[model samples]
Target chain A: MLEIATPFVKKAGEAYLLVLQRSSEFETYTPAVNSARELLVKMDPQAVPYEKGQLGIEYHRVDWMGLSL
Target chain B: MKIILGILLVLGVSCSSTNQKVESTATTDETEIQAPAEPLKKRKTKKQKSAVVTPPQEESEPLAEEKREDPYLGVKEAIKNANWQGLEGEAQKILEQNNQNIIALNALGMAHFYQGRPLAAKYFLNKALSINPNSSDVKNNLAYVTKKEGRSRQAIILWRQVATAGGSSSKIAYENLINEFTIAKDYKKVVGAADSLGSQNVTSVATLNSLALAAIVKSEFDEAEKLLNQALEKENNNEALLINMAILQLDFKKNLDQGRRYLDRISFLGVQSNRRDIVTRLEAVAQSLTNQGEVK
Candidate 1:
């Protein structure tokens, strides 16, 4: 598994670096991903539980009344 | 394991020292000649078998040397260009050669993420974390993947940990979390997040906008007004704040004249003018008031 995971760890490290080097540029993809309101609506019946087991994500519920989607 | 380590040691030595290849050739020749010559064909068979095996082992040495000099800088350039297929392919090849390398896995996962394949990205990223859970980079990437998959809460948690990890990257991760929550209209969380950010590279416009929105959600109109006014003082005649302020004034202030003035400013925003809807409602309200006046 360590053999399988080593390359991914290194690439992830590069991505972390890229986030810093390219901080000023606006990303159209990331914000859409971070949209909690949209995520919540999508989560109702369609969302699958994350494969790695959610470490503690159940607590961040969407305030449904506040949802604009 | 020990045998593998020994092979690697021999391989390293053979690859580095120029004299080693000549020494191995001479030793192979001596061994072949010293073997008992039962039949010419039998002797030839033994020598030919050894010769075939030796070249492959020797050839691998140069390949390993080239791999050792791999340009890690090029990996990033590939990512910037959105050539994730090429990047992932190279990382996969490195893994095929040395399955225990962390760099390859990280790069492959990042490549998958950039390629907009969140499910695959999560797989590699999760595998990387399990190998070394303490890796801040892996954590950040996993969080990013989760966010891309529309798992904001999970992403937020990871970003929080990353931000506190004491690095330039972590600071950026924290700001990204802030921006995400702001766009989601999660103002309550934004207020706390703003305080926790303490001092970082946060922009005043983004921060004040978040705080103003948060205050409005909490029904602290006075606080929201103060924040909006402060923001306007800095960026005079800001459209978003002006529109939001007008919405608040119309809904809560009973000041039609000031509300209209603010709404009129929104008309200049063109496509962003959410005011048309509000204007229609306000007109209805005014019509109702006029009818009531006639009845009186």
Candidate 2:
């Protein structure tokens, strides 16, 4: 399952959205991440994309994904 | 010598006739004067009766005039013209005749209020209210005095009563009540009062903004938006309405992009120093969120 969260911040009377995407496999996550980026860009062409580490969130890889097959 | 004697005799006869004519004319003049004096003495007794009777009649004529024309008319006109000194004088004249005249009392109170004498205004207005407890004009004036004196709670109650009285002055009374409630930060009462005035009837931008603020505090986002929209329709570029809309979008609806659009509009419209600071801070937060991305 892929989980996506967008948190909003206010600065100088403007609101900005921060998008985060998480999944078990990088290959499986890529589509969801790209879709979310496309949606944010559609909403605001100037919206910048960033990783979870940039916002101080730890990134963890799922060990079970590599063990399967 | 004979001719000179005849001429002297003729002259002496002419002088004697002229003297007799002068004496007769003086006697006729004295008789005419005496004749009028006797009648004047006789009429003097009748004149005394009229002198006594005319005083009471003359006294009541002005009192009757006072009753018919309204003694306070001059005072009212003076107040309308912003002639404060003239208003005071006219009101004092009415009060001198009847101490309990409510119109005079109200006029005096208003004159004092305009002159920045709140205490005196309150005293006169209170007295006027005492004379006629149901007089909305007196009550409204007293409420203004109380408001000026910073007794906002009491002023609110009096204004509410005046509004409830329902007369020519009710609309003004309701407006005053809404204003006082807003200033006192009694948002609940402000909402109730504004609602009582009816949404269609609420034309004042300040009242609408107060109602919107009250709705926001209660978390009634839809109502707040509707009221803000109504006010914006009247004043399209109202800075206060724009700011409130931005807050509603960002804080309540969680729509960052929508909120940013509102902020942009506010910047384009221009803001005061204090509001500019607030907008700058909000924009900084938005930019930080944009840079940091979404937190998981």
Candidate 3:
């Protein structure tokens, strides 16, 4: 399996060059990758800049009114 | 068990590059070559291939040939003459007759685009797009407007769509792809786009330099050297080229004197210097490497 090297824009004003090491080539077609915002909370604007793998962490239900059953 | 941890990110700040989210995949890029980016812009197995690229400007000469029988002559002439104001009235008049007219909608969008009115440009172009979703012309124009409006990822989708479709304006779309992806530091896409173009000489100096940088990132040192040399032939004084060429040599442990000389040329640029934050940092890194006898 062939692995390709690619870089990504990390910050404003410059292309932050992230050189990921090669592992195994992905067999399936790459997904329609989401934008940074799209990958995170869609409705919640205040909760941005989340750490990697933060989405997997489950959280208790907390509404804007702050009442739990 | 797989442990792939060699991710060397030379992260630096840059204001010249835009805030664009780049997708890291060759989903739309179909290859005609045996290996991906083995050597950029050489073999061409098909004309169907298209890569992401850049936009156009006013006074477009090819767009000038007055369609004598065409009704939108006023708008066409206005664009040909860079007269955005002149086209606005004519475009609006055509829209008044039939709001869905593609020519009129495109004209209005082009006028707004050249006038630095992205919101208005997007409004008209989106209308035109809704009428003929397959129209590459409108999509390409919309991509430019979207990019300018700071919706770069949206622009990428449009550019990628228009580019892969391969129409009259596909060249422009491909150019935008190379430019945007390069700035976003999405090197694979840049290579993919450049490969699709399949031309050796027409590429600009800046583009060649970016291609070289991409090659360097891929650890294709020989290819990077060739690209950097080709760029230097076009514009030796170009600051980006100088810095990249310097990095290509210094970081890779090539000729010490030449790399140092390249960096020294940047100092000569002085007040009229390339003030890009990334570049300054790259220079500093190279300089420090040499100082510490890190580069042999």
Candidate 4:
């Protein structure tokens, strides 16, 4: 199967970069950790629930109004 | 618009079962498969709803005007006219007329989401869910708003639920979820989801590549290698798949020889025009491998 074009990834990466650039509290650590956790879950769904919850918390920690509420 | 109305009128009559039975029995069993062709022409029905307003529920006055019309057609016209400004009001009116109407609520929520009001969209979508908790449209709309609000986890959850539940939008929801997971860098989930979809279409080699990448990222080298071998069994000389497999070897496995072989496969594909930067990155990887060997 043909993988998505490189330009698509680049464009998405650029958007991600812009989000980082605009934030005063730009923390690459959080996004990276969150991304890593998400990747882990995708790789193996039956992993620890706490681990998934931890990642979910990290992903939403930066939200001004919170992710769900 | 007039043509669309004419088509709908023709469809309304042609859907008559008596005519269908007569035509079918007259044609014998050999032509039964082609009978649906007549209804296909009526697919482009006209929408009577206003440009900016959401459609009303069946009991509402707006529904009286547009109930005969196709919901998708109304949505298209609303979008085409750039009347997003009035869609919420229209949707609200429809809801007021038929409180239990799932379709009106879905349209309202979708309009609100398109108009860039996720919070409002969420409200209407939640209302839609209340009406029909299993509604695929509401779930999809809710997921969309959640994603826009940067709540990708919630979106992923909802999309997965919709995909599993099975609905008209199930495939679309699944595709979007894959994209969302990709953006979130939830590679593990992407791999798992791709695997689920892969079984549905075994001919698609990309699914194997996705699974391989996830395994590589998670440091499951054996699994990644196994999946790559499986993909190659189905396809030979697939440049992207080869490059992906090679990148995994070089980055995670530190197997320079294997990686080089994969890159060589990419070169044979002869599509260098778009892969210039990727090729450059691969060269750096090759150099690093070479340096490590020299140091050894």
Compare the candidates by TM-score and give the number of the best one: 3
Candidate 4 lDDT over B1-296, as tens digits, reads: 99999999988887897788987787875555565575643432222333344344334865666756643454445545656756556556666767777776676776777777778778878987887787776777687777767766667778788788875566656656554544444555665666555434333355455556556656678887887788788877766666666667776678998888877777777644655556667768888999989999
Model 2 chain A: weakest 10-residue lDDT segment is A52-61
Candidate 3 scores a chain A TM-score of: 0.15
DockQ per candidate, 2 decimals = 0.02, 0.01, 0.01, 0.03
lDDT of 2: 0.64
Clashes of each: 19, 17, 12, 7
Off by over 4 Å in 1: A1-69, B1-70, B89-104, B163-169, B203-266, B272-296
Question: Which DockQ-derived CAPRI band holds candidate 2?
Answer: incorrect
How does residue B113 of candidate 4 score in lDDT? 70
Q: Pick the DockQ winner.
A: 4
For each candidate in turn, the interface RMSD (Å) is 16.6, 31.2, 20.4, 12.8
Q: Write the per-residue lDDT of candidate 2 for residues B129-212, one digit (tens) a residue.
A: 788888887777677777666565666677778788888566667767665555443445656776667556767776677667
User: lDDT of each structure?
Assistant: 0.59, 0.64, 0.58, 0.60
On TM-score, the stronger of 2 and 3 is: 3
TM match of model 4 to true structure:
0.43
lDDT of 3 by residue, B71-165 (tens): 67676677667688987888898889898888788878777877888788888888987998888888887777766666777777887787799
TM-score of chain A of each: 0.33, 0.30, 0.15, 0.31
